[model samples]
Target chain A: MSKFYSSVTKKIWMSFMGLFLMTFLVVHLSINLLLVFSPTTNLFNEASHFMGTNPFIQLFQWILFAGFVVHIILGLILQIENWVARPKGYRVKAISEESFFSKYMIHTGVIIFIFLAIHFVNFFLVAKGIIGEIPKTLVDGKSVDDMGALVIALFKMPYYVIGYLIALMILGFHLDHGFQSAFQSLGLNHPKYTPFVKGFGHFFAVIITVAFMSIPLIIYFIK
Target chain B: MDLKLKIWRQPSAHADGKFVDYQVHEISKDASFLEMLDILNEELVNKGEDPVAFDHDCREGICGMCSLFINGRPHGPDTAITTCQLHMRRFKDGETVTIEPWRAKPFPVIKDLMVDRSAFDEIIQAGGFVSIATGGVPDANAIPIRKQNADLAMDAAACIGCGACVAACKNASAMLFVSAKVSQFALLPQGKVEAKERVQMMVARMDELGFGNCTNTYACEAECPKEISVTNIARMNREFLVAKLS
Candidate 1:
């Protein structure tokens, strides 16, 4: 346990788990965007139903949930350890000129955590019929459960769409640092490949964020 | 060739420090920076005043004892050279040069421009060694290290334990120094036997000594007299990971 909790070892643990979370986000965005392509009530219902009832998806979701908890815990641990390592009362005269995303990761991460809580309350609880009964849906010659309806209805609320979009942008900013930094934590940075890794991180963050945010906008404004 | 010097003067560690201005007249351009300072000290002694206190042992630049932040640099304006190797030709006549000691919590001001860097020695004593039994001296080439690994270990070993890296860093981080030491030993087969415990112990000691975290600003490498690469820090991270998992 002492070996597991050592200063350098914690960085690798955080980076591996962060990369795992990044993969999970990619798959999640892909599945969420299916609603945008097929907006018909029955089409979304069938998709959501397939996702809900699949044993593989269920297992993966559990893994993702555990990953989220561990990632956050380890991230907090690493931050605390780094803080403790530094000399007390010493201040740098020079201001760090890195991007806002890179410097304020902990802050952005906290905001994203709040977004996650809202996301869980709005989607996860609703889908499981835990908080409120999901309304019925009928279209495309089929009847469906109300999880898809709840999403569409929530998006229709302008405030909810705006909130979701804001959350996604924060998520984008978090990934901008988290993705590249995790590789750095894992000692994967080399002169020939570091810039490429950083570029890919920025690009991947933008794509995930833009794709996810587009779903809400399409549901709220277009359909 | 006259040079104006603004040297920090403090009677004792508990005394308040301030700069004392002096003018060195007719200095040779070929004179080393510390030699020039020595001439200035002789002048102060002739004037019946206390000479500035600074640290230096080997004028050849290998002892790593000479430390002076000349004109806002660890070793004057030159890159990849220690203070003792710095020449007066790097400065112009009538220039006011400011000299200071290593400023970090771990390194406390002793007097004038001299700072106590025993914190580094403490960190080293924590784990910076391999427990080899002293019998007869082993054959020099018995290890048979790969060319690449030998070169890397030699490069890392080039770090002379200079506190310049700490003084040059914005955060006063000792990562480059600690990592270089760790990499130098860990790269060889003899060192690899205890590589896990070595990295773990060194990093833990580094943190325990109140040094700042490495932000990879490259300042330490830039100002390092040995030009020890930040790549050593990355290597340390990898070694720690391999040790933790396997």
Candidate 2:
């Protein structure tokens, strides 16, 4: 319970779980984006079928689910603890005089979490067979059926695309702080690698935001 | 050189604090900023008024006792070096300087330019140490620390535990201070035995003390008198992950 409740330890937990979730995002984006390059339904279906049936992937799915739960719950808990601990807040007026991202993490993280819920409802539910099957789409001038088509079709909705882009932007903001910060929490920073890590973190955030948002734009305009 | 001073004055930690304005005349351009303050204090004493209260000892800047936010930046307008080490030459003859104490909620103003930094002590007491013991100082070659690791450890150890990092931080985070300590110990073979517990305890204490989380704005490092790297924070996180899993 102490491990669960300790705010500092929770930060370690958050960083640990977040790194795993980051890997999951990479895997998820790779598999979902198969609609654009994979020229055949059987291949996409075969990939999805493999994902649905693989034992190692199934274990990873459970771990990923746990990661999401820990990330969200502990984030909220740590934030609440911070609020309760510093009810008086800083006496000086400084943030407006400094960086903007330092002050807006909570707002951006909350928005991202809201987007996460929507993502789960639309994609996770459909993938798990908890929700009704989404309608298929015509890809490369042929009627195709699979999870990849569902992703492409969902992005075709203008409102969904807008929401997704906003979510990705918020995620970018979160990563701007989180990427370097996680390493700091674990005490991994050093002079030789610190600048490189920060540069890489910013680059990672830009890449992820662009990659995630590009899918929706590609489906709506290019495809 | 003539200079304008806007220094914070509080009767006590319980008393309300406010900035009081004063003027200094015929100051040497080469004298350190604290010398200028000393000149003003002497004038005030000659005038039969109480001298201003500020923290300083070595005045060489390593003690970490001289914590001040000058003109919205910690340790004056300079990139590094504490207020004691800040030379007055940086400022123009007629420039107005604003001096204030560390403003974080965890660091309460004791009086004038000095704030209570016991929260840092508390964080250290919670974990920042190596519990292992040797009978006496062992041979230097016994623990062959790689040159890279030794340098990194020395760099982390360079942190003066000054609240300047906190003062400069927009979030008022002590991550730079905490991470430096964690990294300093974790990098050495002597400190590795307690690495797991040290990170866990130190971080818990940091959060427990009501300090805000690190947002990696680099403001702390930018304002640090020692220019402590934010990389220590990253190293601290990596150590914490290993601790959590194992």
Candidate 3:
């Protein structure tokens, strides 16, 4: 039973974790959009403060972090297994037909990982006051950390803005396949529903990407 | 019609192989792909040279014995047909066709274009069967199966165990093949008794034998001779999940 639960089974769990992270992205992207809607108010700051202080959010944070780590680690392991599956590459590999996004999953995944490291450094470290001082603002009657200020500051840097935009585009590409694929891996497939799922996957990919990209672009251009 | 052939030639599994170019002239277009190969082999034999070795049991395409990676596509450039059923008309006259074996770690080259597909047999042996008593033949109506399920099982059962799915896969993953075997049984009543152990053991053996993980590329379906759907893979996943959880 232990042997049965070891390697390939990780793929099933990774699918669940990958989808969970995708859900987290929807939430994360919505919150980031708060910056573009009203950067001047303490609404974004209040939301951030609540997220940092909320008991449930704090607990979910650990699970979310675990989801990211395991997804990444198992992805690398699967990639290695895939590589070992064919140690000798085909002499003539002319792909007549296959999805374009399906080819460079690891490439896009690596790009997303790099962007995530930089993203966490800019925002998460600042929130924790480990790298930069956290700015405080009063929202409604209570004092809160200026999360929007930190985000707007980062967007002001042209390179960070460009990098963020590119990263979101890559994220979109990753999700273009990842979304429907996770469903397939988890056995949510049917002839009737799969076309819808594929369409929904692409739609979600584009929307999330455009939404996240808008945040950085709006901040850079307006401020 | 005349055609140029660059066929992979390996004397033995341990020997280094290279492409040996040969030209055939005045071949009829209506000739089947295997028939064209037959003509080429005959010419080589007449010239006192070794004939190109390939696999074929039933030239009509049902046996799944023939496999040839022609011009970078499994079973030649045609879609949804085995190499045995492929016609030489698909190739233009004077075209150079490159033939290679099914190149995967689990499927080492036996010689020329033939690969050892026993790994597939091993996967089947792992859990692809149901134990039953014999001696007296049971009535055909003894076990009742749903029409829809019977059709799905028959669809999965259409897999001829050809390595084209693995050959066409970029990662050389046999998920389609393994899943087809698992789904064929998991769908039926007799096979459901051991469905848990079947999926678990087969998947374990698949991993142990060094097949790549399925990344939902769908190339297996695209190039499968039987045109097996990747949905069977999803079914296998569902079975695996249920087995592990329960």
Candidate 4:
């Protein structure tokens, strides 16, 4: 039961990483929104180019990767530990409480993990010049790698669009629980303010999911 | 009242258990569930058959000794009472009712309708104590406390060490029980002295003893005979997090 080695500590770590990833989503969703909302394609290209080349962001990209890895690995371990805690189960099962969103956290998380892997292979590697070649486009009279074009091309394909929508939907559903649960795990619950937190969690989940969804729809419909 | 009982009969902790059907005729609905069981045992004994064994003491419900999973709910269909407090009227005449012991890894079946819940005692021993002493004959106002904190602490202390929370939990998590002890101490001035170490040790012991993590299901509150709040659990999560960080 040393400070860092206990289950409670593991929970604190999970909550910390989870909240950090949640904050990252706000920045990511805003950037991706340019693919749909901006009148000119240059905004997306410039945005993607800047994010790709910024040294500070590049350092943060590594921390972001570490965040995903730690959350997923520790999430799996904590899940396994919980399973071991209950070797025997009820004969006549009764579920009197717990919301559906909270109940399926692990399943949705695994889905999100699978989606992240596919997403990085498709876009992140290309943006980093690690996997595939990027098309060239002009932004501000300078030839820039057309990361936005790649996004458009990928979104035009029916399966990619469908998968993107599905993953975002699950992510939305997960955030519905994750936002508040993370706070609660960190012991942030209170009688006066928890309802507000839950409401904000709902709003955040919808906004992020809808924002991500708008990208594919706008790309396929407009261009 | 005539009733068809489907009771789990297990000989020992490691032995296989299953439901055995029995019919009891002409019993009064006024009889408590345990009293009905006594009648059923009398019939079996008279017929040269082995009598069913179940645990009960303080049938008034304070002891928390009776642990039965009756008709898919802990402590029978009645809310806020133990199995011994449930009267046969809750069941219909000629109805088939299923009864089983508390189901959890930490609570192993010892015999018919009884499981070993000593794991609870082990968890309590981990930190469920004040371990502080004040000089005798202190004034009542010596340690002035806020009414709200005192009342909440008393609420958490009302838990009867029942395993219903574990039985009702999907993961068999003892978070309610463990958190009850944590909350009781966390709110009290006396228990606050070693609060950090207390939460750490109790939660660690809980995890080590194979109790599941709390999903905040609130089933523990719903099934608790004493109606303990999951807020204590919220408080425990807060205490555990702060303790870990600070």
Candidate 5:
């Protein structure tokens, strides 16, 4: 147990949690895309209903929550340790030639955390009946939470849409460094495959950002 | 070449330091960066001023003794060379140059431009060696190491224990240095005997000494005089994780 508390071990945990969250984003974006592409169909509501009510996902939801909390906490702990490592800074700031996305991770992470808080309050809490009422609509004569309606309505507001876009742009930067960083931390780096991993991480970051951003933009403009 | 130098002037480790500007006239562009400093120190001594103290040995880049954060770089403006290897030609004649000691907490300023890097030695003491019975030198080719592994191990061994990686890292992480040390042994059969305990002990000592965690920024690789790859860091991470788990 004492061995698990080492710096490397902490990073390993962070990597696992971060990679898990990355997969969760894929599932989340796929379901959220329904708000734009399949607005007229019952697919979006059905998926939401399944996500909200399924036994497996319901259990997994807590695990997913734990992943986010653990990742954030570990990040903070590492950052604090990093701060203490350099008590006195240099008179001339050391210039960074590359990995620009890597430096401001904490700043980007804080923004993402803020966005997550607003997101949970607006959607997750409402769905859980903790904040506001969950809007309902009949799906095949079975009543379901109108998550699509709630999302579409929120996206319709220019302020919310703008904030979401900004938050996601920051998230893109965070993921840009994070994707390959997670793999590197997990000790998976190799000369042959590391270049590909880095390239793919950049590609993945852009794809996830653009895909998630398109939902809000399309909903605000066209829907 | 004539240049203005803003050099950190700390009398001792406990003294508050500040950048003191000086001018040197008619310095040859061919002089090494340290030789240029030597010229300034000589002039200072001629005027009964305290000569600036810094560390250097073997003027070749191998010893890794000379350290200066020159113009915001670990070893001046050049890449892949130590301070002893950096020439005055890299700088413009009239440009202002800044030089200071490595600024990590563990590497406290000893004087003007020399830092206490003995922390690195302590980390090495933790677990940087393989225990072998005292005997005659082993026969050549007796170990039968793979050529690829040998090359990789040599690359990791090239590290000179300079704190430049720590100096270069924004977090003052010694991961690149520690990783290189760990990799040098982990790749060869001789090192495999105690690789598990070696990695764990070294990393624990590194953390106990207040070195920052690697954030995978690759800054340490960029600024390393030895050009030690961050892959060694990845390998160290692998070795460390396996040690912790098993």
Candidate 6:
């Protein structure tokens, strides 16, 4: 059999793509945190402008998009294959001892996808000059797309805040399982370190969710 | 103890199957789960009814033959034991016990609760072995295997090829079974020669047979009669990647 069609190969690629997207989350949360913690300065706007226009970051953005696309496609394929594997349903509903987050990965994943769609249209497209006009502001004495202002404005809306918070919460659930799961898929498990990885996954999930959720709520309530 | 059995009954592979409820009175609490079924079959036979067909061998845990999904659990709610090792004391009096076969596309129900597990045999035939010269018995210490590796390999070797891992999986994945087989050989020096081809071939056969890919939910580990660790799965993944890349 060709290695491309192998289940293990598909899972390995999925792991790589998942880990890549997770790194993007780290970078994203770091920059967005500036919006809440350093609102008075141009740090958030400058960081956002840098991310949007920097040649290296611009080149990496396409790779990032590919990461998202590949992850979703592979996930769907595996899930479909999983469904087909069990054509006959059991008469008695078996009680599963699996983690609640692990069982509904696809559900949480679809919600995250929806959130990403709306999120890209709201910020990414606007910044790219594809949808609405980019709001301009002076960053380091040069006018650039003021992504921070747009983010703050959107967060101020109650509905947007509510939706964003819910999506972030769902994302937390996805990451809680995905983080350690990615490691397992990559065959990186070790008895000495696996527990640590599992713990850190939970910690990472909570941190990302809380940090992202805080920005919007702070913007709406305090800022 | 008296019990109500909701057993799955199908005449043949292509026949329509349904749950047929039967009552057993004064069943000994000390009787094994299979023994309980045996008594029920005896009663049915005496009544001139079709006996519930199932699988069994040594009536012990090692053979991995007895496969009954009792009460939504493979091997009747017991951990680290097969169906034959499960005793009736695990259940309460008058409890309704549900019995079914291992549910997966690869393992089709042959009769009532017995499934044809020849798919596992086919996967094993693909490549689950190390080819060695048959000239002479090699000296035991000549190969010199590490204690740690030997222990781990033995742990992987503990798998009895039962379909419980497949049954318990939400996706009917054979990852735990295949991984255990792969690791049993992959962890040893003798197995090093054909390790690459072994994992690749077994995994391919598994996918071809329509077993699902593992999402790492670990339901297999929970329901495994032998309690095989999922670490073997990670080891198999590592072996597969190394094989593919090199």
Please list all clashing residue pairs in model 1, or write none if there are none. Answer: none
Model 1, span B165-222: residue lDDT tens: 8887655778889889999989887788788888888888776776665545567877
lDDT of 3 by residue, A1-223 (tens): 2244544487688799989999999999878777768747477887899899999999999999999999998888888878888877667775648877988899999999998998789888889788978868888889889888777777899988887888889899999999999988998889899999999999999999998888888788875
**Candidate 1 chain B weakest lDDT stretch, 10 residues:** B209-218
- Could you give the CAPRI-style class of model 1? incorrect
* Candidate 2, B1-246: lDDT as tens digits: 999988889989889777789999999989998899899999999999878888888888788888777877888887778888888889998998888788777888888888889999998888888777845888879878899999989999998888988887765778889989998989998889899999889888887677876656678877888878877877776777788779
Docking class for model 6 is medium
Q: RMSD of each candidate? A: 5.2, 4.5, 1.9, 2.3, 1.4, 1.4
lDDT digits (tens) for residues A61-163 of candidate 2: 8888888888888777666654554444334444323445646777888898888888888877887788987554554565444776677677789998998
Docking class for model 5 is medium
Q: What does candidate 6's lDDT look like per residue over B182-212, in tens digits?
A: 9989889878778999999999999999899
Evaluate residue A162 in candidate 1 and report its C-alpha lDDT on the 0 to 100 scale: 91
- Residue A76 in candidate 4 has what lDDT? 82
State candidate 1's DockQ: 0.19
Candidates 1 and 3 compared by DockQ, better number:
3
| Segments of candidate 1 deviating more than 4 angstroms | A1-4, A39-62, A87-92, A95-102, A130-133, A138-167, A189-199, A216-223, B1-63, B66-115, B133-143, B163-173, B212-225
Ranking by TM-score: 5, 6, 3, 4, 2, 1
Between candidates 1 and 2, the lDDT winner: 1
Runs in model 2 lying further than 4 Å from the true structure: A1-8, A38-63, A80-104, A121-133, A136-160, A183-200, B1-5, B21-28, B42-50, B92-96, B123-150, B182-207, B234-246
Order candidates by lDDT, high to low: 5, 6, 3, 4, 1, 2
lDDT of 6 by residue, A34-148 (tens): 8878846389888888898899999999999999999999999999989998999787777757766989899999999999999999888898899989768887789987787
Question: In model 3, how large is the Cα lDDT of residue B11?
Answer: 92
Error of 3 at A83 (Å): 0.8
Comparing 1 and 3 on TM-score, the stronger one: 3
Among all windows of 10 consecutive residues in model 4 chain A, the one with the lowest summed lDDT is A1-10
Lowest summed lDDT over 10 consecutive residues: which window, candidate 6 chain B?
Answer: B129-138
Candidate 1 per-residue C-alpha lDDT over A1-223 given as tens digits, one digit per residue, 9 for 90 to 100: 2234555565677778789989988877877777888746566677777777799988888988888888888767655544544343222232222344655667788899998998898888878778888776765656567676788888999999898899899999888888877777687868899889989999999999999999989888788
